[model samples]
Target: MTKEISFIDLGLSEEILNALNDLGFTKPSPIQAECIPLLLEGNDVLGMAQTGSGKTAAFSIPFLMNIDVNLKAPQLLVLAPTRELAIQVADACAEYSKYVKGVKVLALYGGQRYDVQLRALKQGPQIVVGTPGRLLDHLNRKTLDLSNLKGLVLDEADEMLRMGFIDDVESIMATIPEEHQTALFSATMPAPIRRITKRFMHNPKEVQIKGTKQTAPDIDQSYWLVRGMRKNEAIVRFLEAEDFDAAIIFVRTKTATLEVAEVLEKHGYSCAALNGDMTQQLREQTLDRLRNGRLDILIATDVAARGLDVERISLVINYDITLDSESYVHRIGRTGRAGRAGRAILFVDSRERRLLKNIEQTIKKPIPEVALPSKELLEKRRLAKFTQQVQQQLESADLEQYQTLLEQIQAESGTDLETIATALLRLAQRDRPLILPPDPVFKPAREYRDRDGRNGERRLRGDNRESPKRRERRDVGEMDMYRIEIGKENGVEVRHIVGAIANEADISSRYIGNIKLYETYSTVELPKGMPKDILKHFERVRVLNQPMKMSLVAGKSSEGKRGRKSNQPESDDKGFAKKRGRPTAPKF
Candidate 1:
């Protein structure tokens, strides 16, 4: 077995070790243990590891220890892919260098004015972290001095490629001194990245830790399908029903943080909004309250929650799904820490299925589906909790004075004590009702389409090898025949009906069965157990610019071979079925 490596084994200075221990970390992760030694030894290193795998510490620890604080001419520089990541890296470095004196770290990213960054650069910080584009801009303006730079780190190199910054990254790296120490870290090493590493480094050491699952196994990740417009209500319903100590709900924009929090507060939930607009003093106080269990829910934007570690957060909700998969991973990582079981819930629309699938593929785990809690289930839970609270209060209470008062009131008013007690209980519970009104049912609206113009079914569509008798009598399997108003008379084609139904009901064409057209109407077969909402939408589908007005065709069930006259068209199988006890298809 491999021996466990502690922070001391990496030969970190006392200041750095003290910072790590203060943060409740004793042992170093595999990548950290492997890369720290080489980084401290002044060797160029290339690391391949997944996000959230202690990659930041692997380089930051050594970069902080080796920097010459007095020179203050950018001794260490880290390039990140996104502004969020830039801030996160800078924050982690600041924490690691807490005990080390005179190590000035500045984060430069876009969105803030250039003048702000220029002012900070004039201070001569020893370490700088920024995005490729922003860093290149600073280099072009000559505001950032790289003459004394000894170490350069490229963080999330593959993410930089995906964000179309590889050329910019190359330009920025080219400006670094030839003899500077370099390190490149990426989740994936594409061909271009490998070529860059070979061209830039001088016999660098490679440390690769295979992509381990970042999401903790203790987290129960789930998603609830909701409409785009009704997301607020859906989230409120979940919060009302689920038992969570504290939660961090993530939104897309800073404005949305306040808006979502206001909605939750309106619905009687204790919530606070955290965003970039807040002052630093206010943000720290908000965080302190959250950590001390005074805050129940916190609505925050992505950037505002960077490096926020709170153990009391038992749940994380993705109110708005992020386009970047890494952001989703980072948002959910706030919970399920320190071996405690946690829950992550994502609210998504039916049209966002592709996004959901992308997240699952990126995380390498399937998030199970969770339905909204029903009214009955919520009521049962509320009643049980109320009963438990009452039981506890009664067990510890001294009821002597209250019992004497109750007897006096009963004697004076000549009314039973139970009646007075019931009235008082009702008054006490008026502010927050134990039983809430039922929430509206959630239904997703999405369409399905097929590439082939045929009836949309994937079955064979070639010349019939069987005789007309055999073709007419073909088994329908376990399918239900339904009638549509559009037919040959309305200039309706098979593709038109297939497209209309597929797009309206969001059902695949493969699920559709045999279709027979008639002069007045048409008939199509579909599988059993279709969703009720989907079926309801199908009745409103328009084919050839007219409502199809579909409905179930009622009749007796037909079995065995269908017998028909030789002269009749094969499409006229409905008549033979009608004569028997079976439901008939539309006549040709």
Candidate 2:
């Protein structure tokens, strides 16, 4: 066998090594071992590795070691595809450069206030990490400077392409000095990404690490179909019934991390939220607590939980399903480490079956569908836990004084000892009862048969037998027609529109009515009198990287048809309506 290479073998700086040692990373991963030496030598490196393969450290250590603390005008720029990943990269870089003083790192992304970023930019940080769009916006506003840049790294290049930010990336790269070093990392080298490497990189060294497709065999994976109850309620019920030492609940957004953690805390769970907004010290302290068994549940976003290893984490709950299979694997991989058996439970909504299917295909195994924990099981577990607590108190505590007081009270009230004990038990459990209320009965949506005579049980679509034109002409009873700005030209399908609306709006597929596709845009039927806030929210919901700028069609007549002919475009032989200008109606 080949000798194992440590971080020292890669010639990283003492400061970086010290930080890595503190972070519990002794040996470099395959990618890190191969790329760090080249990066330190000022080579343009193109790396191909799967997610969670230590790509951040492969580029970060060398980059941190090369930073010039004297010139704090963005010596290095790292571009990520999303805000979460941007913050995550900045956090990792900050951690690696902790010992290397005077190296300021700032994360710039959307959703954060402009004044906050403006103030940070004014500080002249040596390292800048941001999404392509937000970075470009700052560049346009002249708030960011990269004149003294030494290198630029693109994290998740392929994801940037998929999210329609390749142009912005190219623009940002153009603004950087041509002689600076460039490093690009991606899971797959697609055509566009390869073109970028050719245009931007100079004789880049290619490092490809072939990853083994394997999940822990000790992990028992399953999913719960989210139907009748809210996800927070479901999580509380599951915790009450299931036996687990500790768990990490994964959510999608930073806001959701706080929201879910708050709900669990209200239910008396010893949990905390981990997200991008937390300080480095706070994040490390939170993880330390988790490692030592002080925290039982951790509500976190995907980026916040990167590189998280805890032996006590016996379970992982996907409170919100992940967008990709690789993330699903990584999330579940948090458990079942060190030859320990673990459990992974995914919560699947009705509209997220396609995402579930994608994960199944990737893992090459079907995650069995399960119902939520029943009331009987929850009550049984609660009673057992209460009894165990009482037993522990009886065995460990000195209750003689309490027993004498109870006897005196019994004598004064002329009641038996049994009655007094029962009354005290009632008082003790007044806030939290030993029995749970019955859950609402879940009614699954109706499944329609496809044209192939197969039951499309989990598909979020209407009848497959009807043509688009026929379905479009059907009377949309109690539903309103709205046009969304994405169609055949953007490679949007009926299911894409349906899934986007249903998943984003948290509405049932049955409530979404007929859909008509055109070249540039499409019209979807939705329930009438939808909240304005929901309509405004849909304006930002993306389908196939295109935003659904949804707007209500003007002037609906009694026959469920557009009152004005201008709003309805005539259909051709292929059932695709001809392109038209913007609708005359006002936006929601």
Task: Provide the overall lDDT of each model, using Cα atoms, as 2-decimal numbers.
Answer: 0.72, 0.76
RMSD value for candidate 2: 15.4
Model 1 pairs in collision: 556-581, 556-582
Please give the RMSD to the true structure for each candidate, in Å: 21.3, 15.4
Instruction: Name the runs in model 1 displaced over 4 angstroms.
Output: 213-219, 222-363, 366-384, 387-407, 413-419, 426-588
Candidate 1: C-alpha lDDT: 0.72
Query: Model 1 reaches what TM-score against the true structure?
Result: 0.49
Q: What is the lDDT of residue 230 in candidate 2?
A: 62
Worst 10 residues of 1 by lDDT: 458-467
Return the TM-score for candidate 2, rounded to 2 decimals. Answer: 0.50
List TM-score per model, in order.
0.49, 0.50
Please report the candidate that would top TM-score against the real structure: 2
